[model samples]
Target: MTVTWAGANARRLARQHLHPDAAATASPFAAPGDAVAAMLGAHAQVLSAAELSVGLRGDGLTRTDVRTALWTDRTLVKTFGPRGTVHLLPAADLPLWTGALSAVPTGPNPFPGNARMTPDQVEEVVAAVGDALTGAELTIDELSDEVVARTGPWAGDLVMPGFQAMWPRWRQVLHLAGHRGALAYAPNRGRKATYTNPGCTPLPGTGALPALIGRYLYAYGPATPAHFARWLAAPKRWAAEQFAAQAASGAIEEVAFGEAGPAWVVAGDTDVPDAPLRGVRLLPYFDAFAIASAPRERLFPGAAWERALGGGQAGNFPVLLVDGVVAGVWHQRRSGRRIAVTVEPLKPLSGARLRDLEEQVERVAAIMEGTAELTVGPVTVGPHA
Candidate 1:
């Protein structure tokens, strides 16, 4: 069956719990942990972004609540997850994430010349990382020292053309350690962060890939093997093999998405209700809903494609959604107790939509623990715009 774009949008809104009426449901998430689980995970390249993403879903949740889950309660973990980017996942799900991610072969090291470590050296660094963080939280410098001591002095050699100054060769293994469940970001120590083991023992089996793919489809379908591969940063062939196996087992089925052609969804998910999309959300940067959806042209549409996405890079800026579709881009700036939120809409909004946007601005400010002052009009997008 061919699902119209609007039909898909409606289904997506319901699945994402973005429809306004979903807030009143009996099982509405009461905490950040519940929200994270419902969404599969929250993109967490920025901690504040993840907090806002959770707060947007859960009624009465706050940044402090998210912090409590991540730090005090330890119900959530910050680690390199889908797409090899930092994400906030429910701590209990670490085994599934680690098992699935560990199976994907590592891509070529980006660092050039002596900066690049051989596969054996990389494995040694990964092992050293596990040793360094076992039962202890250590800052990057401390972890680097431990790696150099365990692996050799070469692990500490500086590699130029790094993200910020020259980074140590050992740094390359950090994400791999997280993917392998041997490392996770610890609560901040003063102004710096540390790393620790997630403490989840992997399940003794190979069901992880199928389980993960199933969860992904449930949350982010109708997607293709290519989409899954891109989302997981796995090899296309590996994703295709997994998809084929799942399909053979009747775990997934194919359907046509309007204009986007064939896609796959978890079996039995083809009967989604056509819920009306009725809400405005100030989705923070790297919000999972926007990033997970493919056929960006349909999701963003027209000028919004350029305005909201900004050169096709997802997560560069927060987005403004009207009735589950990208309508604008927004930014927030703080000055004392007030946050100035500037929204640039690709098209004029209805009075009701404008009020919804205002309410969303208030929500954003509340997440920041400050009063909100909104400006709707021509605003330039920039690093701090």
Candidate 2:
């Protein structure tokens, strides 16, 4: 059956718990960890953004609640997972993420020329990281020292030039350690972040890829293999093979998504609700809903794309979602006891939407634990530019 974009949007919004009325219902999530588990995980490259991502989906959850889940309760783990980015995932789900990520063939080393380490050397570094981080949390510098000590001085050699500085070749293996379930971020010590082994064992079997793909579709379908591949940062051929296998097994079924063409949803998740998406939301940077949706042009239509996404990049700034579509971009800055929130709409909003925007601003203020001042105007994009 062909699902129109409108139907898809409504389903997506409801499934994500972003529809205003849906969000108002008794929250499906009982805690911050529940929200993370439901969404697969929240992008946590920026801790505040990740916290807000959970807060938006959870009822009456605060930033402290998310921190407690990550540090105090240890119910959630922060690690490099999909797309090799840091994410806050349910601790119990680490096995699935680790096994799935490890199944992907490692891509080329980012270091240039002779600086690149052989595959063996890369494995050596990964092993060293596991050893260094085991049983104790260590800052990056401290961990690097241990890596060098374990793998010789060459492990400390700088490579991979960046806009500001060069990164050590050994640092590349950090994500590998995470993918192997040998590394995760520990609670911050003073102001410095540390890493430690999470002590999670992979589930006994070889169904990791299929399990991970199933979870993805449950949260972010109906989508194509290409979308899954892009989200996982895995090769398209590998994704297609896995997708085809699942389709053959009746684990997933194909459906047409209007102009988006053929897509797959979990075999039993084809029912799209006819809910109207209302109200405005101030979704923070790397918000899962905005980042995971496919057929980018449809999710982010017209000037909404350029205005909110800048030069086609996702997650650079917070977004303003009006009726389940990317209607504008927004930024929030906190100082002392106040937060200044500025919004730039691609088009004029209705009076009711403007009120809904104010309510969202209030919600943002509450999340920050400060009073908010709303300013409606164009936003200056780029990270703190």
Candidate 3:
């Protein structure tokens, strides 16, 4: 069988790459792992608002299996650190994948225009926040207050200028702490900050970071270092570090990605290629398989990126990937009973493909809390360049 380049695209590869079990490559999440491994690998967490919203309206159904997956194998996690947003990533892949994300360096010289806190100040804030969050969960405000009290009123002012600048580091600290020790979001805080320690047992921590990159490679790989960097908001060097780590572990191999630059092949044994989009999938707005790869052009080529994600910021569109490559954009018309979907195509979707896409939409509507007729509107075709 000859591998063809014409059909080679991220979305196409992704549908071919995803696991049916949804269990990640990490061990605890894999079958037959100890409770400690499960806790250490992928401690399940409720999806953040964006995470829930992204997947809710599309390809996935939030069901009992979703919950069980959360427990037995690490299935859900707070996928965050890029553009300062949260996503729900698979649990087993959480640690190392997140590590790549959190590895952003905290430095003063870097990122001028209101530079970040001084090294001493950064160390102090991290230590103070870690201490405050160690025993139990605390809201950011609550956590900040504790840190301020420990230091003084001036402490908040001292950190005020650095707040947003340092948030990634701060978020990383909390997440890593939650992973290793026990500092999680407080229940008092809303779901965003509502974190708790899963107190059964913990794994002998494998360290949070390089692990994240490893997961991204295995799950969303054949991707470039830049792709990882872009996806995680990480420095190129950090991306390189992650790739290096995975390479050391024999977790990755090199592969061709056409014009998308270098891509690493996931080295772990995987089930043979099984393409599901052959079935038409109404993906949740940000189903990671679509959004996780970062650059829109590299992932969904053609003039689609701007037309889809480029109104305000780049790549902010809910895509419609028909038979792989982003064939168009889609949205939900939430009425009362049924959810209406309007698909705007970049190229005319043929009758058969259109039927396939509709079948995917029907599944999406069924995944909702209640049943309703799913009507895929007329395929509005055009080269919306």
Q: 215-275 in candidate 2: lDDT tens per residue?
A: 8888788899998988888888878988999999999999998877899999988877666
Candidate 3 versus truth, CA RMSD in Å, comes to 7.1
List per-candidate RMSD values in Å.
1.9, 1.8, 7.1
lDDT of 3 by residue, 212-312 (tens): 55556554555678777766555777668767777778877665555555567667423234434342444444444555553455546776666655542
Model 3: runs farther than 4 Å from truth?
Answer: 1-75, 79-84, 89-115, 134-137, 158-211, 241-251, 267-279, 311-315, 333-338, 372-385
Whole-model lDDT, model 1: 0.82
- Candidate with better TM-score, 1 vs 3: 1
Question: Candidate 1 or 3, higher lDDT?
Answer: 1
| TM-scores of the models, in the order given | 0.94, 0.95, 0.65
Model 2, CA-based lDDT: 0.83
* CA-lDDT, candidates in order: 0.82, 0.83, 0.47
lDDT of 1 by residue, 1-385 (tens): 7666676666665666676666564355787887887777898877888998998877778889999999999899999988778999998888988888888866665767878888899789888888888899999889889889998989888874567688888887778888888899998899998999777665533688888889888877888898888777778887888899899999999899777789889998886557666778788888888887776677788787777776776667788888778888888877897888999887898999899888888888887778999999876866324
Who wins the lDDT comparison?
Answer: 2
Q: How many backbone clashes does candidate 2 have?
A: 0
Give Cα distance to truth, residue 334, candidate 1, Å: 2.0
Q: Candidate 1 regions off by >4 Å?
A: 24-26, 383-385
Per-prediction tally of clashes: 0, 0, 15
Error of 1 at 372 (Å): 1.1
